[model samples]
Each structure stands twice: as C-alpha cells, then as structure tokens.
Target: MALTPLSWCVGAALALVCGSSWPKMHSALAPENEVPLRPTTWLPEGKITSVTLPKGKTRRLYFTLKKASAMSVTISPCDLPIEWSLAARTLKDKPLKSLHWTTKKSMPEVWWRGPGTEEKIHSFTGDAVNTFSGPSHPRTSIYILRLRSKQQSTRATVYLHEGPGPSGTFPLLPADSNVHTLGVGMTSVTLSWAPSPSTTSLHNAENSYNYCVLVNSLQNYPSLCAAKVSMRKEKDQKQDKKERRVTVWPILKEWWWQQWDTYPEDQSPSASLEDEYDDLQCVCDGTDSVCTVSELLPDTQYYFDVFVIDRLNGTNAAYKGTFARTHEEARPAITSLREGELRWVTFGDLRSNSEQFFSFRPRGWQQSGLLTLQSCGGGDKVKVTVSSKGQVLTSQGVGGDLVHIWLQGSPSYLIHLEREGSTTGQISSVKDQALPGALMASVKMQISSAYHRRGVPSLPSTLQIKSFNRLRGCSSVTLAWMGTEERSLYCVYRRKLEKLEAEGVSTLTAPCLGPESRSDTERVLCKYFQELNPRRAVTTAVIGGLEPGRAYVFDVYLMRRWGIPIKYASKMVKTRKEC
Candidate 1:
C-alpha cells in the first residue's frame, strides 16, 4: 500500500516517540550519487520521504536495511508520468552501463539489476509493487531508488517499506578510485588506481581481495559483480559450415586464403566475437594498484572496470572510469648489414620504458655474428632481444659496460630495444615487468658479421611456366607454373599485341609490364590482382574473359616478402579463334 504525506508524518511521529534508532544510510552524498540527496532526506525504516523531482531531471535516493527482508517502493499522487526503478546498489558511485537506462557523466547512480530482483519499471499508472531480497547485519546494504520526471515537475511521496525474510549478511566493499590508463604498448595496457576506502575491517572469509579488472572492447563498462554480467559462449558452428561451402570453389577458396593471410590475426572476425564478453585474465588478487593487460589488439580502444571482489561471499564493486587505447604496431626500421660492415645505431630520443623495433638482414654469414652494446654514461638502461621469424632467440640486459649477443644462422633477424625506468608518473608495468624510479639512459648498438666472398642470395627460387592452354575457351586459358620457393606469391600482368604488328614479342624480349601500362592496341591488366596459394609451392591459375584470336604477353613475377616483385618467368600465348 502507498503511504500518503499525512500518514508518513504520523508514522515518523510514532517512531520518534518510541525512540527507535536506524542506521544512517546517507553517509556521503557527493557527486557520486548525482542526485541532490542530502543527509536530512534519508528514509528511516518504515517511514516515507517526500521529494520533489524537477522537470527533465532525475532524483535519486538510497535507503538501508538492518536485516534480510522483502522491500518495495511506492510512488503515489503524481501529476506527470514518471519513470522510476528500484535497484540494489553495490559499490556506491560506481555506474553500471545498461541498455535500459541513459547513462550520464555526473549521474553515477545508474541502475544495476541484482540477481535477487527481477529488473522492472514501476509507475503510478501501472503496477507499483516491487519485492526483492537483500542481506543485512555486519554492514547495511544500500539500495538506490531513482525517479525520473518525464513531462514536468511533480511532487511525490515515496515510501520504502521492508518486511521479514530469511536472515543473512552481505559483504560490504568500497569502490576503487582514479581508474585510468598508465601506459599502453602494442599488445598490452598498463592501468593504475587507488584502493577502496572502508571503515570496517574484513574478516577471514571476506579477507581475500581479488581486484578483477574487467576489459571490454566496446565503449560501455562491464558489470560491478561477476554474477551480474553473464558471459555467453561463442557460436562458431554456423561459420564453420559456411567456410566448408566456400572451399568447394577453387577460385573463391584461393581468394579467401589470400585475404586471411593478409589480414592481421589480432583483428580477425573471430577475435572480435571472442572479446564481446568479459575475461578473467586481468585480475589483480593482491593490493597492488597497477595491472598490465597483455595479448590485446594494437590500435584498438578498450574499456576497463575494476571490481573489488570478495571471493568467499561473491561480492564485488566497480571502480570509476578507465578508458585507454593501445598503440599501433610500429614498423621496424630495416638495415642490411653486409659482411665485415660495422654499423653504429644510437637511440637518443627514446622514451622511458618504451620499445623500438629494428630489422637486421645479415648477408654472407659463414659463422655466427657479434652484436655489441655500449651504454652512453647512463649505466645500461636498455635491454636487447634478438629474434628470428617471430621466435625469440636470446634476450639480455646491457647493464654492464659491454654486452654481446652471438647471432646464429644467416636468416633475417629482428632486434627489439627497450629503455627502462620512468622519468615521470608513479610506476608502470611493461608486460607485468615492473621497473621502479625515474631514470633515463641511452645505448649504442654495433653489429658485425663474418662472411665468405660469395654473396648469399636472399631471392626466391626459380619460377618456370609449365603450360598455357587455350582449349578451355576462345577468351580463356589455363596457365600453370612450377616454383621451388614455398609460400611464394605471384602477380600476373597481361598485354595484348597488335594484330598488324609483324614483330612478335618473345618470352625473353617481351617487356614485363606493370599495372600502369597503356596503349591503343596494347592494354594492361587493369585489376591489381595478386594470387597466393599457401597449400602448394606451385599452382595453376585459370584466366578467362579475354579478346579471342589475339596474341597476349603474360609476365609472372615472384613477390618478395618485404620488397618489390622480381621477374621470374614470362610466356606469350594466343587465344584460340573459337572454343
């Protein structure tokens, strides 16, 4: 039943006369609560509070419970249609972004549907009864009752009455503060925040503090508690069925493989779907305020919410805002070190605790090479890691006056140099490797390799045209090639020969045209197409829809891994007059 203003006053008088004492629910009413809920407007147990909700504004108020009970909120005799919801508040001032409510910056009092409550809207025109279970004792559980005015300002008397229910106690946790990004790398993000402030000391069962850092790729934040946010399993069966059908056609299958190979693995379709829900990787169980989330996609925005979780009681609270973006993958500077050639690379403007990449292609390495590092009076602040084909071969710190890493094999290698220490800020985590203090350092890198006089070839193996047949159609032909280089790509270029021209373009003398060639009778292959088949070292390509009876010059070039395409083989084939 709804309580009127006169009836609520009479009830307050009775409670005052009986000398009944209730815990003060409204302890702190700062910007966290958003609404102008003062300490005087607190709703005592079994009493009604009158509040005037202004036009186009939301009014929020919270009440406390001393024991486990069924609670309900009743709003009566209002002029305009008001939208209101009763949500169990956990982690005061922490806003849980929901699809149901409009989340404002100042209004940290967003609605979070607890497990015991069936999230519903109550208004004066419809059903006003709401019942939910909440635990009490050890500490009071605060529930936020928000009333939103739609049409105009209206005065309403809100009554919050609790009844008897099963007795229990809920864990009381405080919200974290200053949640922000400390630093970001290609695949990692470092976060720093302050611990929650609580007066009551936690017991043995509620002693463990597992600070869960929920990361979401979307703009919205995750839920405060793990129970509130339900993570769903990804459904990939339908996608697998579609991929099987696409593989039946050879052309489509080849195109799909080419696209997949070129696409970054971090930004794939499956990667986006997997990040829709929250994961448990970023949980900082200890009291450390710094956490580095690793294995994330580069050049992407990620939202973070810190939850103070009590493992025993399953209670949690969300921290404030945490939004940071990872940086894009930096392209390494390529440097070709010839035999007996000494190159001195210096890093003068490198930032603290930041990484820089350098690609070193050593030619004619008859034996292992030597990489020496020298610190420029800053006592070895740089660490060097040498890797080949995405595999780390060795990593060492150049803390001493001299450091050397013996490079083995003649394959192309990569050198990752990272500077340590922070010139500013409290502290930062690099892949969870913490470095303290505000220090700056520089190092000079020198690389030299021994080799034979003969130049070691870094080019792809031979590519020979096997056959070019025009029997398929007058405008189409099947071209096949053989190559020894595995995972080699090819770009096909075609040029039509003039009919009246007496000079026949041979495979040797014919000019290998790029996509930009143009003439009256001779036309270039307009489409910038490249074929890749990782399943085989050699393959066949079917070229169709061409001008019949005209001789065409075709050139095939093997594309290098990081360089321009080199001319491998060429063939001149005339299309048949008819099929």
Candidate 2:
C-alpha cells in the first residue's frame, strides 16, 4: 500500500526515533540476504560524475561520509527525464522494512520497498529535473542513491560535495509583484520587475542572487516556474555558446513511417502543446532586475516567470511573472536560389501568409541532389514538402532545426516552406490556423547537385500499379499493385480532380497533398502499406471516407526501407454518385 503524505512523514519520524542496528536484525533479514543485485557504483565526493541509467532499470550509487557533516548532492543538468530517490543508512539503523536486501559479495543492498528503519530523504521525477540539496545526518552514514529511467535509456551527471551548502530558507521572500513587459518585438520580449526587498542585502557581486528566467509558450506557467533550477558555480571557463543543430534524416524517416496521414486535429491541443514545447521551455539567468527574452514567435503571447534564485543552493528565493504577445512581423521578400548557392530564408509571419514556395531543376537526366534545410534550433515548426510533377517525393516536419532531402531526377522539384499553425485553445482570440507561434527562424535552404556523382539510388524494378476498380462506391475505391519487393514502404495519396483544377493544380504539378489542408478536396490521404507478404505477388488497398460523385487522382509511391521514395505510379478514378 502506498502511504499518504502525512503517513509517510509519520513513518519517517518513527524510523528516526527507533534507530536500530543492521546486525541486530533477524538473521533472515540481515545484509547477507538476497540474491543478485542491480548495477552498483560508488559516488565520489567533490567531483562531477556522469552515469548512464538503462531503460526501466534501477542503478545503485553508494557514498560514504567520512565524518558527521552536511553533504550537498547535485544532479547536474541533463535532458533525460528520470526518477531518483536518496536514502541514508547508518550503522545504528536497521535495514529498511519491506525493502529487499540483496547482497553482492556479502554486502547488502536495498530494493524498492521501505516503510521502516531507512530514512528516505528526497525523490524527484521528470525531464531535466535536478537536485542540489541532499539528506543530512547528525552522524556519519552511508547514502544510497537509486536512479531509474522512466522508459528510455539516458545519461545523468552528479556532483557530490561533502560540506554545507548556501545558508537560507527556500524561496526566501514572497512572490514578486508588478511583473510586466518592458518591450515586445517580433522575436523577442524585454521584461522588468521589482526585486524583493529581502534580497537587497545580498547585492554584493560575491553573494549576488541569480534570477532564473523561465519562458514557455504554454499556459501552465505555475508548475513550470516551480521546477528546480540547477545552476552550479563553476570557475570561469570558455563557454561554447553555439546552439545545437538538428539533423533532417531521422525526422524524415519518422514522417515516412507515419505516412503523414494525421493532422493536429487527431491530438488534443494541450497534448500537442506538451509534445511540441517539451524542449521549448528555455531557462536563462538575469543577474539584474531587467531581462530580455529573445527568439520568440511573432504575434504570439508567451508566459514568463522570473525566479530570484540563490547561486549557492540554486533555490528560488522569490518569483514574478507576466504574459505578453510579440509584435507583428513583416513578410520578407523571397530570393531565388541558383544551383550550388546557399540562401537564407525567413519563415513564420502569418499576417503575410508566410508559406513560401521555390522550384529547383536537376542538372542532368534522372539526376539527384542533396537539399539541406537548417535553423538556429527548434526547427520542427518549419514544415517542408518536396514534390515533382504533382507527386510528393517527401514531406515531414524538421526536428532540431535541421533536415536533408535527396531529390532524384524530377525535371524540376517544387519546395514549400510554411509555418505550422497553432492548435485550437492555444489563442482564443484567433482562429486555429490564424496564429502561427514561435517559428520565426531564418532557416537556410540550399540545393546542391553533389548526389549526381554519388549516383542516385535506383528505383525498384518490379513495382507497378496493376489495376483499380472502375466502379466505386460512394465513398471508397480499391487499388491493386504488383511488387516483388516485400520490404518496401508505400503511401497512397488522393486528391480531388475538381479542387485540383480550381486551384490551378495540374496533373503534372500537385505536391500539396497531406492533412495540412482544411478542405477534403485539397487534402492528401496519407494511407500507408508496409511489410508486404513475400508469398503474394499482388497487394490490394481500399481507400475509404472519400467524397461521392467526385473525380479523384490517386498516386502510389514505392519507397525503400531507408525512407527514399524512388518509383511511383499515378492513376485517376471517379467515385460513384450518392444513391
């Protein structure tokens, strides 16, 4: 049974009062108790150590205090989201109750359960969560730290210092007041606030408080602001201010795998915000009362929280917050790129309908080129689609602000760049697609014919569309294709003939197919087929939920396991009229 907060506190207090020696415990419950132990290591004092936590596995770390002193344990900054607990065992304390004592080389280790003798100091779980203060014993004892990764394998850094940390109460003062913006720009916001009077005494540079500026695009500011800030006071050293770059291939592979079928509507607004903004929360230090928050989205409101933190303990002394919308951005003129030339393109000003299109022609027959798109960081907001002759070669969202696409000889390839819009409930005053937030990035788009020398990857020879049902139901159609390759990936795209004509989209130039469009006539159905049976030479698929009495064009693209769509076949079909 899990203990309530009150019960847990009461149990811990009783454990401290009835401190019993481990050796005095029942023989069966002694240190030489159970079988095999999990991975264990000793945590060194006064140095930083990096450790890896296997997925869903628990690792033990032991640290011995030489004397009775206050020890400070700091879990350094990391991206892995994990759960960790700190416990201390003294010579006079008995083995924690209900905890399995597994021995390794005759030494006992605790596993999970504990409602008795062991004093549990603290526990934390979440992404980028760090600890700065540890349990303190009046006398020397062994501190055992256990780390468990939630679902994925990740690395963690730990700093163990044997001494007293900074002296002060957590959140030393009340919440800050008069938190307001000083100025707002298309991509930045300047904020100013009054410092708590209690913090004025520590104005000296040596003992100054560091203000942690927490910014996020979501409205869940309270919990975000309440998160611990890990700031270590390290000696001055050269800092690498370079931003991290995201590669495009992994994202492209993911897009190809998902087949670009679902849209933002398939997910809840809050859940969408959580996933997209997981890395969007940025923390910076404002040593003074004023700070400037940059790299914000144009015409979007962002929540800001400033916490007065002590440098020593990394504790939030006080906090203040406000929300402000960025200024409207002017649409930038598109500059055409010549072959082998790199050009910077600005994306994300919705007032001017910031979707920009560019076309590229391969230099040789069936030639190939490497198309690279790069951003400062958080490039997932910029969506890219490369198409030739109305068939989408590839479409995917860029992660880490970087992506690469290999273009095979399409006489000319059309590239579309646009800001992915905010979801419903993001901004109540604006429509769902009206406000595009936080994607104001000057992404670099470049196309080079270097792949021509590398040789274009060959298309599958046996893949071809065999036939389709001429008579179709009001909402469905059947298509059959022949391919000997059992491991290839396939996607079926459907576009309305009437809408294609109205938009002036010819059978030869339609790349705009995907769920991104608002109208069914313009939307591309992202139907996927994978893991074809090797025994069967023919594969069949039924396209459903289509409009009746509508003439539609369907395209089948054959892709390799590596996510490159090499061979494709297109056909036009008309759905039967509604009865």
Candidate 3:
C-alpha cells in the first residue's frame, strides 16, 4: 500500500519530533543498536558512514565542519528493498534542503503469478549526489544528516567530500563525463551530455565558462576542426582613455541544432573557411548540456566529441567520442530498361488528346501486362481512353488519383487523355505499366498543355509511339506507347533498314493468316506476337538479344479476329557497341 501525500507529510513531521536518538522500546526492535562510521582514505578529512533502519523507523547523524564551505554528498542503497529520504539542517534545527528516493521493484506480484512464469523482473536501483554551500563562518559549525525508511528494513551508505572553493583552480581533467546521441535523422543528429565534474564541483558565475563540440565524418573527411574565432574586448574609457582592452563573448547554447548562416558575423569564424567548418565544430554555453548538429548527408556515418572548456584560462578537457549513422532514402526497383524487351510501362504524364504509343517484342514464355495511373494534378475533371486496331477498350473518367487497368497478354497501345472542356486547362498525369512476373520500367514524364479546339474522339485513335531508349552497353531498347483495346492481338516487327537497303531486299507484302498459321514471308517481318485481354491504356516493352551496335526499325501492328489492313506504330533504335 502507498501512503497519501498528506499522510506522508505527517509521518515526516513525527520522525523529526522523535529527535536524533530513538527510545529504548524502538531501539530494541531494530537489528542494529547504533549507526556505524566506515573509515576511508578517499576523502582528505571527511569520513564515509552508514546507518541501518527497521520498518517505519528513521536515523539521524550530526557533523561538525572545521571551516565554512560547500560540500558534496552521495547516498546509495546497499541492494536492499527500501524507501529513504535525506535532509540537511543547522544545529538549531533550521531546515536547508531534502531529497527522497526508493528502491521498489517495478513489477507487481500479479506479473509473476500468470502463465509467464519465466518472465524477467526489473527494479529501480540507483544513487543520488548533491552539493550544498553553507554560509561563511569563522568558527566550527554544526550540520545535521537524516535518513528514514517506511518499508522493509535496509542499510544506506553515505560519502562526503569537500568541494572546490570559489577561487580554487579548475580540475586538470573532467570526471563523470558521458556523451550519447539523443535523436537521429537523415540530415541531422541530436546529442546530450552530463555536466562535467569541473562545472558541478566548483562555484563560479554562470557565464564564466563554455563548451566545445566537434563533429567529423568517419567514412570520408578526416579533420573538421580548422576554423577559430577571436574574442571581443570590453573597456571602460573613463578609467583609462589611452588603454585598450578585449574580452571574448561567452558562447550561447540552443535547444536545437543551428545552421552556420544563423551565427553572427562578428562572433562567427572567418567566412572564407565557412564551408570547411560548416558542421565540424560549435561553441556552446557551459550551462547547456545538450545540442543538435545538422546539414548531414543521408546514409552516412559520423563521429562526435565534446570538451569542457574554461574560457578565462583557455583550458579544455575532452570526453570520449560517439558515432551514429543516418538513414537512406528509398530507391526505385529498376533504373534502366532495354529496348525491344517486354516490361511494364509505369510512371509517366500525358495531356488530353496527346497520343502515346510503344512497341513491345515479347520473348519466350512472356505473357500478360498491367497499366496503372497513379495520380493527376490541376483539379480538372479528366477522362482517359485506351484503344488499338480502331477499337476502344477502356474510356472512363478518373474518380480519384489512382486508377488500375490490366491487359491479359502483351499488346501495343495508344493512350489518350480528354478533359471536360477547354477551361479544364493544363493537367499532369502519372502512369506506369508492368508485365507479369517481370521488372517495371522507369517512365516518368511531366505533361503541360493548353486545351485545343480538336473535339474528343468518339472512337479509339491510331497507336502512337511516345518514346524509345536504347539500353547502354546492351543490344536492347525500351518503348513506351498508349491507346489500345481489350482482348486485341498485336505483332512486333524489327528490320535493319540500312542492312535491307544495302542488300537490295525488296519489301514483300504477305496475306494475313490464322492464329496458328506461319508463312515464310511473315516470319521475315514478324519478330514477336501477343494478345491483350481486359486491356490497358498504356504499355511499355523491351526487345533484347539483337546484334550489338546495329540500327533496327521496330513496328507494332494491332491484329483483328478477321483479316484487315494492319494498323501499326514504329520506332528506330541503335544498340550499343558494348555488352
């Protein structure tokens, strides 16, 4: 059970009224008759001591100092379950300051009683250190130290040390120094540190000191500590008109990281060296124990070090360095797509009535295609239509930003955009295409257009090839296209125009054949064939395994169920010399 705040206050008052020594009846219940003082050589004149308390009991100790000054005290538990309080007071019973702490187990009995019998238990076990300065006194002065517990019987130990006076020399090195990263991001990191011994153990004005922080990239740059700033001077003209003086300003510490441009020109280092020390070093207030460093690159590792500096003496003590890595940004799946290859065409922008076409040459065992419209901008009411072989497959108004259209097999397409009216103005479209079980093509485009007087087409228009890119160092190229119908058949043909002209091969026309028919002249022109079902508005294809450094012309023809004139789109590409 826990005591209420009012009840706890009452208990503390009663303990104080009981005096420094317990009565015989209460003493008899305690395991120890008196508190013990442990001898130690760590303190020059003070002593280490301890006291044991039983349930609901308290103990008090008195100290007489030879001189008046500030003193440091550390109180720690002896691995026993208990709650304790420490208080300071003058011999006349004038209260000074007090601190309360506990070592209670975190988990309750219910945590270990259930099915999780093997669960680990946790508890609070830590120590506290404090410093207090007393009023100056010529004669010996008396002080009081009190310890109390309300729960299980336990022992508490205390360590006392004389702190440095106002004029004492600073420590040669820092103690109890710690550094750690508080937070990390792609371009910035926050850091925190505990106050050094020299800062906490001595007495001085708050603005008398400053701290220096150094940051360096461990993976690349070597030294980031090159820039330096000169101190400014303050002078009293009335005292000495002929004399000159200078004084360095105390550095200011901020709660968050600051950029170099935010620093004052007079207080900052040389501007010529700004880039050299942009994120390398910073000077902060001595009282500030936390700061942030920014302007870091993503996916990079960096090291940081902190030093306690005494501005008056220009003396500094360095703490150990800490390291952290920034996170990397996500990347696309495929960076490049070769021409004459079957690939999903995804991610491009198109304008109203702007015809986009692509030629796809299917390889062995390749089938199926997908077209997706991810988003559109300009807030205009827009509709997109896809067609092939003069047949409209899909023509629907976009209700939201995202739209998906699937094609059963590889087929060339002609995609067109149509807005409600000319007032709809310029719009941007983002679309992508993909093949089943294959990599997607990178085809991002930004389309800007003014509505034209040409009315929206009532039927599917002819296929148009939008763009063609040859894969570097490979005998392949990628093609992007639009406008196709659902459940339509298409064929891809590639011919070396230069080679054919050089060999004097005449153009031959062959009659259309059935689905399973193969003619010698048809084989000469037809490189690949595919049938599209449940059609899409956009398509992209890759053609590979051709002779390197050779120029080839590609033609995509939409096939119909009955014999009809071939409606086709074509593009020419040159393969790279290297594989």
Candidate 4:
C-alpha cells in the first residue's frame, strides 16, 4: 500500500496532508458504480489497514476504505512491464466473499480470480482464473486479518509487493525526511501512516525506505508495527534551509547500522550496500523462508527504513537509521529473541505455481514457488530453518536491508522450507531460489542462514532440564541448566508444570533474568553463571509469601525451544518452608 498514485499537492510544495481516526477517515463514501472520487471516501482521503496473500502469489494490491466501507483498488503499473496479483481475507481469517479481477496486459499473459463475484475483468494479455479457492489460505497477512486489542499486544498485517529489487528508503528523497528533534528529550510520539507491502523482489527495486520504531507496552503499540517511512523527520523541526535536501545517493551506509558522527561533506552510498544488495530479501533468496532482524544498537532511537538498492538495472533497497536523544528502546534488540523463537512454526514445500490458473497465471519459473518465514513485524524477517535433511547449507546471513537473507540453493532432491510467525511477528515478500535445471542442483554450496536476530544474541539451542528443589515459603524453587554459554544475551523463565494438561498451552509471562547483559567480562560472567559443580547450584526464585507447608512445582524455561521442554509443576511438588 505505498502512497496511492494520487498526488495531494496541487503544486508539489502545496500538498495538504490528510489522515486521522479510522472509522471517520476511511469509511465508505463512494457508492458501487461511482466513477469519480468522493470527498470522504476517495483513496487520498481513505485509510487501508490490511492486505492479504493467498498461497502461490506475492501480494501486489489490497483493499482500502474511503470511510470504513469496502472500496476497490485499481492499479495502472505506470509504464513498467510488471505483472501483479491480489490476495484478500478478513482480519479474523474469514474468507472474503465475492470480488474478482480481469486485466488487459497482452504480452506476458494474464490470470485473475474471484469465485463469488463473476464480474468479468476486461484484460488484453492473459487468461483469467478463480483464486478464492477454499478456506484456510495459509494466513499471510495475519494482522489486518485479526481483531486487535489496544492493550493485549500489537497484531500485524503483511503484504508482498512488486519491486525493482531491494528498494528500501525512497530514492531521491528529500534529505530532511529523517531529520527530527523530538523537541522534548523523552516524550512519547504517535505516528500514523501506511506502507506498501509490495511483493516485488528486493533484488529488483532500486530505491526504497521503511520506517521502524521500537514501541513500548503491548497495549500502546498494539498494531505489531507503526509505520514504514523513508525519512525520519520529527513532526516539524527547524534547521538551516540549506540542509533540507541532500543528495543521498553517495552515502547509503547511513541506512545500515553505524554511527553518523561525521556528516559527509557529501553523502556517499555505503559500499556495504553494493556488497550485500544482491543477497537481500525478507527471506533467504531462492527459498520461501525469510531473514530476521540482524543488528540493533542498544538504547538508541533509531529512525529506520528498509530500502532496496538499485544498480545497472537490478533491484535493491538501502537500510536507513537515525538516532534520537530520548525514546525507549522500541523492539527486542537485534540480539534479543522476541516470543516466537521458542515457539513452533512450520514451512512446507511450495505447492502452487502461478501458471496453473487462468485468472492470475504466475510464471512458475519466473516466480519460483516460495516458502515463507513468519514476519517479526508485518514485513520484518523471522527465524527460519532451511536444512536439506542430509545436505549442509550453512547460514549466510542477511545483507544490508532488513528483509534479505543470503543462502545457497541448487540441484535437486534436497529442498525444504519452514518458518514461525504470528500477528506479533512480521512477514513480507520472501524470495525463493530459482529452480535449478536438475543438472546443476548441488555443487558445494556455501549458503548459510539461520534465525536472523536483530542484534547480537546467543544462538537458540536445545537444553537439558535437570533436577529442581524448593527453598523458601514464597513459591520458592531451584533448577539447574547449561546451554548457550557463548551468547551475548539471554533471558530465563519459570512456570508451574501442572498446566501441561495434554494438548495445552501455558498462561505464562514471568522473567527469570534482568535486562540482557551488555558485556561478557569476567565480573559480569561470574555474577551470572557460577560453577557449583556436583552441588548443582540451583537457580532459585522466591515470589511473594506462600504457606509454609504448601505444595508447589516449577519449570525452568528459556526463550528458545532448542531442547525437550522442561517443567516443575507446583501441584506436582510440595512448597517447603525454610527447607
């Protein structure tokens, strides 16, 4: 949902910004056959909160509301010989009934769908097919599909847009777009805007940028994401008029992770951009899985964007960043694990190709089937596993943009994909390797990638649960463990084992450790993990006061599901007093 092609400014500089509350701004104003724009419901005056993706195709366009009423979106593609598709669903997973497409693209052939609504789409290029097949369309953009609560947690909606390749922060953007003052050191600011969940391959887009900010409270930031803007201009700040626009083509490194202590006499695109552009996408190239957050600076208000870099004609987006004096660290550091890593998600072999149907016949070859890694943020990457069962494809890591992952895929007989995400995570256009002609499948591929963390974190691993003991009257307990000793950060969890009643989940949200450790120095090391040896120094916990002879049980947990789940149920154990 990039800004609609509509230009609000009559004279560019005279643009009038318009956006407010949802029910009021995007409610339906246009009637069914209205050919012209309505004052209240036109796209320029409406709000689009979600986008959906059915299996087999990347998301290209989505529905928007002129005033909370359903409105059809029309795309022109603007001189580019690009092909696109559409996916839609209710935020609650309900299949949207009635709606169809017909095109006139002539050359590449056309395909379209819509079972309920038989409106014949007028097209000149390809054949049309019905897309709304059945129920359970693998929930691509789950956020916009689900009901959201302001306090519980933010949900996310995902989209896969067409791209020139890796286009992140917009090219030719005004230099001051990201300039901000905050005015006050530590005040909360609310940003309302929209982004295009384009399915275009990150490798094809030449310019792009997305806004990302760490939000506090599962309630305040309940949308799972805020906005994806190229520049980070603080509401309205004043600076020398000369600094308003700067040619950023030369200094692209500013988009990645780094310090901007030295303002370039002129901005030079960071070489790192070119070094990693070809290898970026929300997921590992040639695979359905996506790349997660790779690096993040602690305690910095990073004005961030995801951009695809462009070159002699390939796609690309540049990573962008900005620092603010006072804003809480909004997201789990690139080093910290959010919530899903320890959870479970699966990836299956791509089953649908664009060519099968007549409505939207996607080229099975040009658009290789994809396996998606659930997003960390609607369009952010997540931790994914892509092992060839018997083959060794090392983790290559994400390039400059936050979406891409570098890996090797070739030959035959050895291909798989898996991912984990929910409304709390992100997902976007994930790239899969082009299917190789059986002859060149495997050849000592150096591809390497695993769960992409936003910052430096101890890799997730399996753990062995040891014995547990009771200590004080305060729901006291002790446990032993050993794993991820080399991790730069870690978190611990404790829960009563009784809740594991067969096929069940636990209502747990308790911390076992303080904020992540900043350094692995000797003093910090000794304070965290000590060698108790045979004694098995128990990691103890004492919540409020408990009855002396009460029975209690505890289970030690980690943010990772690397090993068999460990538990110590209170109902299964007795609470000891001064034992």
Candidate that scores best on lDDT: 2
Candidate 4 worst ten-residue window by lDDT: 353-362
Model 2: residues >4 Å from true position, as ranges? Answer: 1-38, 91-117, 128-135, 138-141, 165-180, 185-188, 193-287, 293-297, 301-323, 329-579
Residue 35 of candidate 1: its Cα lDDT?
50
> Which of candidates 3 and 4 is the stronger one according to TM-score?
3
Q: Compute the lDDT of residue 420 as modeled in candidate 4.
A: 24
Question: Candidate 1 — worst ten consecutive residues by lDDT sum?
Answer: 245-254
lDDT by residue (202-302, candidate 3, tens digit) is: 57723444566665552211111111110111233334555322211122222111221223435532233233323535445656778788777789887
Query: TM-score rank, highest first?
Result: 2, 3, 1, 4
* Number of residue pairs clashing in candidate 3, backbone atoms closer than 3 angstroms, sequence gap of 3 or more or interchain: 39
RMSD of each: 28.8, 28.3, 24.7, 35.6
lDDT of 1 by residue, 182-269 (tens): 8889888888877654213544432444565666664433233121211211113344442221111001112211221223435543
lDDT of each: 0.49, 0.55, 0.43, 0.27
Question: Whose TM-score is greatest here?
Answer: 2
Cα misplacement distance, residue 249 of candidate 1 (Å): 40
Per-residue lDDT of 49-70 in model 4, one digit per residue for the tens?
2322233333332222222222
lDDT of 2 by residue, 65-165 (tens): 77735777655324457788888765554455454333332233442222234678888887543555644676434678888887777666666777676
